[model samples]
Target: DEEGQPVAAHIPGLPEGAAITEGEVNIDLIPTHKLIWDFRIGDLRKLGWIIQCDRKSAEWVRDRYGEEAYKKLSGKFGGTRTDGETEFEVNILDSLNSVLYEGVGDKQRVVTPTMRSNDDVQLDADKMIDYYEYWHKPTKSNPTGTFGIMLADQIMEYTPYPIDSYPHGELPYIPANPISVQGSTMGGVVRISQARPIQREINRLNSQIDENCDVMGNAIIMVQRGAKVRHSTLDNGAGNLLEYDGKGEFRP
Candidate 1:
C-alpha cells in the first residue's frame, strides 16, 4: 500500500490490487510551481535531489489510502469541519531514478526497487489499483533498471521521476535563459537593468521638450504707452487685429 500498510500476509505471484490492464494508460501531469529541486549544474542523474508536491482533497486521500491516512494527514483545524473534504499536501521524491538516499541519524540508507517475475499470470481488472512506474537508468549497483518507493521527509513518498526516455533522462524543468555566468549553471540575462535606464532618459527628455514648447507657443502682443487698448479686442482666439498709435516703444 502507499502508506506502507500490509494489504495481505502472503500472495501467490503478483500482489493483490496491482493494476496490469493492457489498454491506453492515463498520465497526470504535475504543475511546476509545486516542484522543488536542486541546482542543475550538470547532468540531472548526478544532481543531489528533486521533489514533486501534489495537492489532494481529503476525500480523495481517504478513498485511495484509507480513513487512517486522511485523519493523520489533515491538521487540527481539519478535524473540526463537518465535511471531511479539505485539500492536503503530499510530496514525491525522485533521486537518480534508481538509488534513493535517505539519511538516518549519521548513516544513509540506499534503497533500490524490488523486481517482479517474468512469468505470465492472470490479472483481475476489477481489483486493480492505478499507479505509474518511472524509467530507471541501469547502474552498476542496480543493473535491472527499476524504480521503487520509499518513505521519508515526514510523509514524503520516494518514487521515480517521470521522463520520456532513457536517452534524455532530464528533469522536467526548463530555465528561461540557457546562458549562465557560471559555465555549469543555467540562467537568463537581466533585461530590466538595461530597459530601466533607457526608459528614465526618455521620460526626462520628453518633459524638457514640453516645457520649451509651452513658453514659445503662447501669443504676445505689443501696445504703445498711453495708447488705449480694448480688452474686447484681446478676446481669446477671436482673431481681432490690434492697432497701436504710439510713436516710440510699446509695452507688451
Candidate 2:
C-alpha cells in the first residue's frame, strides 16, 4: 500500500456536513469537480464572491491587542471562535455601518440603509456632481472634500473589490462611477419613480401656509380715512389702527 499506485477507496469520507449519502464511495460519486470549479470561477462570479478577513487586519488587531483580542477579531472576522474554528469573513452590514455611519447602530441613519425614503434616495442622486468632485477631491471635477475620495478608495470599492462580494447596499455608488451621469451641473441620474405624491403634499402645505398668511395680513389692517375729512369714519377704529408690527408701522 505504501508503493505509489492507483488504489480505489470509498469516497474519502465525505467532508464534515457533506450531503452525500452514507456508505458512499469516491469511485461511485458523480464527477463534478469541473462543474464546481466553473461555478467558483466563472461568469456567475458577477453574482458575488467570497470576502475574507485580511491578514493585515488580523495582524493589526493582534499586535495592538493580544491573543484574546486577536481571537475575538478572528472569531468575528474569520478567525477561530474555538480552538480550531474561525470565520473567514465579517458581516457586510456591520462593516458598512462601522465605516460609513461612524458606528451608529441606528439603521435609519445609515448612509446606505436597506430601506431608503424617496427624499433620501433622491438626495443621493441630486448630489452626483458633488459626489464625483468630492471623491476626486482637489481635482478639476471636485475641488474639495477629500474624505469622500478617501473613503470610497478605502472601504467602498466595488465589483473586483471584496465589498462587491456582497449583493446589497447599492447606495455606495458615487461620481466617476459607471452609474453616475455626466452633467454640466450637479446631480446623479438615479431615476426616482415614486415621489410624486410626497411632492404634491409638500406643495399643498406650502400653498395653505401662504393663503393663511394672506388672511392674517388682511385681518391686521384697518381701513383708513383722513383725519381732516369732516366725515371721517376711520377715527372710530383708531385703536384698531394702532395695532402694528415691532417697527411701529401699520403692519397691514
Candidate 3:
C-alpha cells in the first residue's frame, strides 16, 4: 500500500482499548499555466523587472519582438494611458491596415510602421541599457541625465548597509561578579561593587539568564572585584557611609 493509504480493516490481535488511526493524506492540483504566468510576472515586477500588455498582445509582442524587447518596452511604457486608462487600444490600427494593403497585385512590397516618426517608438531592451549607460556618463548636452545618474548613485551609496553579512557567534559565558554587598559580622562589613563595561555586556548577561535560569529564580548579579565602592550602610543602625573610602580599591 502507499505510505499514507488506509488499510481496509484493522488487525484483530491488537490490545482491546487500542485503536488504529490512519495518517492524513493531503492532495492538491498543480497550478495552471495562467496562474503560474501571473505569479511570475508579479514576482519579476517586484524585483524591478517590468511586465505589461494584455495576455494576447503580450504573447504576440513576445513572439514578434522577443522577450527582452518586450520587457524593456513594458518598463518604458509603464504608467502610459492609451485609451482613457481603460484599454490600450489606439486608432493606429487604421494606419497599420492602410500600410498593409497599399501594394497592388503583381508588385512585391514590404511595409513597416513608422513608430519613431510618429512618436510611438517603444524603447526596447538595447535602448534602455544604452540610455542607462549614457546617463551614468553623459555628454555635455545630457547634463540633466547626468545629474539624475549622480543622484541615484549617491542615494544607493549612502543607504545604510544591511547587517546580514555579520556572522552570529555563540555568546561566551561570563562569570558573575558582585555589584554591592551589605552585611555586618564580627570583623566588620565589607562592601563590593562592579558594573557592565558596555550595554552589550548587559544584554548578553540578560540573554544568558533567560536561557539558563527558571522564570522564578533568584536574580543573577554580576560584579567585578576591587571595584570602587561609593557608599554603604550598617545593619539596622545608622552609621556614616564613606564616600571614596580608602578601604575600597579601583582596578582598571
Candidate 4:
C-alpha cells in the first residue's frame, strides 16, 4: 500500500467472499539472509543504485526544464517529422545544434597566413569559430530563472528564445551513486573502496560463525579419562547401554 499498510486479499478457496480480514491471510516473510547475501539492497535502492536509460528527447527536455519551457522551445524550434509520426517527433538535437551554431557563419573561420601557428596546425579557437553559450539566472519572480541560448555578449532578456526557469530542479545527467558536499554541485569518491573495510569485517565474522557452528554442531560427550566405553555403541541399537568405570575426567 502507498501508506505502507498491508492490504488483505481474499483467495478463491478462502471462506470470505471477496473480502478477507488481515488475520485470515498468512504472511510468510522469508529471512533476508535466505533471500539475498547483501542486506543493504534496500538501502542501495533508496540511494538510487539502479540502471536506467532515457531515450525520449522531448521528455528529457520537459523533465529538466518546465512543461511551459518545453512548449515554448517546441514552438520556437519546430520538431522534425519522424517516419510520419508527428506526435512523437522531437527536434531537441536540432535545437541544441542551432543554438550552439548560432553565429557560425558570421564568425571568421579562415585565419590569415600570419595568424597560422608556427607548426602549420591552426586550432579551431585560433580561427575565431565561436558558438553561442547557454545562460540561466534566477530571479525573485522566476525561481527556476530564465534561459538564454545566444552569444556570450548577448543579454538573457534580449535573446530570441526567451523561456522561464527550469522548474524541474534536475540536471541533464543520469543520477547514480552521487555524494553531496557543501559548496560543490557534484563530488567523487570510491564507493567500493570505502565499503571494503566493513565488507571485510562482515566476511570475517560470517566465516568465524560458520566454523564455530560446524565444530560445535556435533554431539560432545564427557567421561572419566581412564574410562573404557565402546565408540561403536553410540551407533548401536536404541536400548543398548555403554558403561564407563574409571575415575579421571575426560572430554570429547
* Candidate numbers, best lDDT first, in rank order: 1, 4, 2, 3
Q: How would the candidate models be sorted by TM-score, starting from the highest?
A: 1, 4, 2, 3
Candidate 3: which pairs clash? 177-222, 177-223, 178-223
**Candidate 2 Cα outliers beyond 4 Å, as residue runs:** 1-201, 204-206, 213-252
lDDT of 2 by residue, 75-124 (tens): 23322121112121222343454345435565534565443224433422
Flag the better candidate by TM-score, 1 or 3: 1
Error of 3 at 68 (Å): 31
Q: What are the C-alpha RMSDs, in order, of all predicted structures? A: 22.0, 23.4, 31.0, 23.6
The sequence of per-residue lDDT tens digits that candidate 3 reaches over residues 1-252 is 112122223254655445444467454221121111224433221221111222223344456557775565554432222222222223234335336443687674547544433324543322211011111111123211121211111111221111122111111111232333344221111111112246668899888766554544443222354344332322112223223323357322
Give me the overall lDDT of model 4.
0.34
Q: Give stretches of model 3 more than 4 Å off.
A: 1-40, 51-86, 89-95, 106-252
lDDT of 1 by residue, 1-252 (tens): 222233232233645666433468565434333335556534454533345443334565558657775455444112112111212121122222345475778676557563442223522211211122233333334333344322222342434433223223333334342343565322233334335689999999988877765656644565554556664556433333344566665423
Which window of ten consecutive residues has the lowest lDDT sum in model 2?
128-137
| Local accuracy by lDDT, each model | 0.40, 0.31, 0.30, 0.34
TM-score-better candidate, 3 vs 4: 4
The C-alpha stretches of model 1 lying farther than 4 A from their native spots are 1-27, 42-49, 76-153, 156-252
Q: Give the TM-score of candidate 1.
A: 0.28
